[model samples]
Target chain A: VEFGGLRAHCPEAALHAARAAYLAGCQATSNVEAGSRFGIPVSGTMAHSWVMAHMDELTAFARYTAVHGARSILLIDTYDTVAAARLIVSAGLRPAAVRVDSGDLAGLSAAVRAVLDAGSLQETKILVSGDLDEHRVAALVASGAPIDGFGVGTAVTTSADAPSLSGVYKLVAVERESGMVPLAKLSPGKRTVPGEKQVWRVARSGETQRDVVATADELGPPGGVPLLRRLMRRGVPTESAPALDAIRDRCRTAVAALPDGVRRLTDAERFPVELSPDLDRLSRRVGGRDDQGP
Target chain B: VEFGGLRAHCPEAALHAARAAYLAGCQATSNVEAGSRFGIPVSGTMAHSWVMAHMDELTAFARYTAVHGARSILLIDTYDTVAAARLIVSAGLRPAAVRVDSGDLAGLSAAVRAVLDAGSLQETKILVSGDLDEHRVAALVASGAPIDGFGVGTAVTTSADAPSLSGVYKLVAVERESGMVPLAKLSPGKRTVPGEKQVWRVARSGETQRDVVATADELGPPGGVPLLRRLMRRGVPTESAPALDAIRDRCRTAVAALPDGVRRLTDAERFPVELSPDLDRLSRRVGGRDDQGP
Candidate 1:
């Protein structure tokens, strides 16, 4: 959403929704067109840029809402966010939500909700989006900030905490005149398995742990099933993937199941992934035990 | 051209071309085409990826140059760089240059250059590409490393040292019934001057230190000119951007007279960039001042 600039420097949940609604307008045609192909949701939200573009906060809200409709989300923090919330509630038009991008979001949320309830607009949602990743989101939910959604940016795009994924694109197998041949790379410190690969993630009855990976052409099967599902083949989508709400729910589920090791904030333990005997044998053979590769 | 793949990663003397004759075929056409469009240079050198791809250093070199031709740059630090250099020099068409991605590049460059010279391949250039940016390049050049070019990546793309420029597309001015009206985003910690704006750079009479900057509208007649140039117009490129070589030269020239402030690696001085009197007047009216523009 950040890379797509759906929401940026947003100040209130109302603004978040407003931005998202605005982006929906811009991306609606494209999303409809893309639905015929990959079928993915195009998302966004109103950013502080809109506020800066208008002469005054009231004018910005009125202009955005007039053009975008009551599906609007008003930003509550360009000036005194509490004061602006009063202005928003008095408007009487149902807003998609209110946004809190700065200050103590919890406190502001409570105050804003109280005011909204007093004004009889109890259905309005609250959203938060400022430097939030899974952990922060978890903390916010745990603390009961009333935030219903997020608009993550820099963190999502840059993946700043762990910038580079260890996932590497390598030529594990090569097709010769006869058949496919497996390959591997082994340097002083860098080592990789050779040949086509497969990963079987073994999970406990509930908790996720005890995963074992083996080469696709292994003699014995591993404890779990295949991890690599065919995502795309020959530039075609394998499945419709899923709807936006469904994907978001999956994200919630995945994040909820993350173990303490995987979720730790600092000096944390890493999730263990072991290779099976068959995969080890194949790796050693393809990579060569004696020499550090070629 | 350091960002470019083929601009003599050893730092060419600033070129407008990475002309490959029929003797060479660059990477997947888009890589070269994009380079041409962005004025980036296509660079190549043998790395463990290729070595492991072929599972043999010699095979990797042969295949790479077979496609890339006379520009083949072989990675020599697989096991022993010097030993591999000897092998590369002896077995087949001597590599155009042997790269030492790891270890002391300066020392390795000397030894590699000497070896190549002794073997009568002076045409072979020693190109190095490890973690190098402009500073490192300047340092190597100052120390007289016999390196021919540099293939700088991460630093330039990521702008590692100073990640993102404090760049913002702002609403500087807007058309109104009463002449053009200046605008501003008077948010706390984020105050921008309003209206259609220009940045003028006034260099000292003889030195590189820019003396002053006046908005285009504020420039007094033609005697004391405007310092800023219209870098972009109507969200489009108005001027032909310089080639990588020329851009690099401009960078050198610009940095050379940077007035000892913003150039420091540590507790350095902050370059003085004062606003024009008209700017100050406008800012005062808008209740804003730019210590930095974000």
Candidate 2:
């Protein structure tokens, strides 16, 4: 429903992020473009604007439900959440869900759940969304809020908490007349590791133990699987990309293989990323003794 | 040069924002699509990745300058800032400018300027960019940093400080059987004024004094100039949009007419947005006593 919230900012980025999220195990997206482009399932309710567009909230609900029918997930918090809940039942319109976009979501979800149960509308789910991130989602789950699912925006689209990832395409190695010469930025607090690299994931009994970033030429680490594969060659794709469902399934399996501590929503333990001996040696040679010096 | 720094995240949003900035007084944008779409001047240099791809920083600089000639703006902070400066002058490639992408911008710019002047490359401009915002630019100017212009990203494209603006497309009035009926959301902390509205600005001697948001039906306030004009009737545009240059000029004039306090880069005073008498009356009537009630 709220894909427009982020889409209004950047249609391209929002579509990309939605596709990524969908391919990373998200059940559905509200972005129609994401659905049309990637064949992902699209889901949404109505916006507060829809309710605000009507003379009265009840009329808005009736008109929307009349048109959208059982597919309607009426937005309830535009004026009064509880009042809207009572009104939805009183009008005898059965919507798929009632969404709470603002206010205390956890408490309100519980309260709304009670209202629906009291009205014997047990099948009607409650959906909540407001500045939702992983932490908030975990908190709501921990509190046992009766929210069936989430409608996340802003945070996911913007990558809010850590909006920009620190990625540097540094001079790892340069093609020289004599041979490949290692290169690195020795800038203080911003030194680069030298060489074309590959990540080696070490798993023990189906659980990831650690990852080693190594020079691509190095012999494969014992009991390690290479994570990076050649995706393209000379500006052409090496092979067709996997189906979105297959990728999502692979992601689910990989995530399930993580240790519980590393999977926690908040204060999760960091996974160890070690450098291979060859890469470390090259980095030291290129970076010199004082790594901080420019 | 650094368009990718911002473009990598939100291509759609960045392009839209770039076009908007171009139309609103910005001279040029680094986005190619923005330029192609809006016929705005496109500007850019090379990223660190381009330099890092070469055998050596100096060789990279020489090769780029050899091809691009005087139009090239050599990015100097990829490896060593000062060393790159000396190499640029020593290699006898007088680039149009030298850009600093990282490190202490204010101090580095001054130091780079000294190097350029000492090398007798006085005409070669100094461009600096790294996490720069309006406040940072103002501070750089205040500190007498010899910078030519800026390469602002992230902040402008993402509206980083306040990413999302709360805009509501509410039904001010609903068409009814008899006539149009005013409507408002009485939701706590989100109360809205009813009826179609128009903003009237009261200016004296070219500086804006105040703005009154009035019911559309209300007669124009004395000495007030209407700011909002009908741009479209039904779906079709009322008229072709004004030329980008004209809009840019108008934006510049409008910005210049702002009060100095409101124009400050930091700790700026808030501009008052007042409601018209009729609108205020309607709000009170719609709100009732204890407007916080559900």
Which model scores highest in DockQ? 2
Q: Looking at candidate 1, what TM-score does chain B attain?
A: 0.69
Model number 2 iRMSD: 5.9
Tens digit of lDDT per residue, candidate 1, span B1-294?
333333221222112223221012222211355455544445556556577556566777778778878767777775567777777777656667777766677888888888788778888888776657677878889789999877664444332343222355666665555556666655456566654445555556534444444444665423343546677888998888665456556556667757666777557777666666777777777664342122
| Leading candidate by TM-score | 2
lDDT of 2 by residue, A131-209 (tens): 6877898889989889998887766666545545446456577676667766676665677887789999999999998
Q: i-RMS values of the candidates, in order? A: 9.2, 5.9
| DockQ list for all candidates | 0.23, 0.30
Candidate 1 lDDT over residue span A1-294, tens digit each:
333232222223223333333233212211222333333444434666676556566777778788767567776665466777788777665677777666676777788888888888888777666656657766777787666666554443333443222344556767655577676554444456766767776656655675677778664343466767788999998888566456556566655665778867666778888888877887777655453333
TM-score of each: 0.73, 0.87
Docking class of 1: acceptable
lDDT of 2 by residue, B137-175 (tens): 788888888999888776666555654544656656666
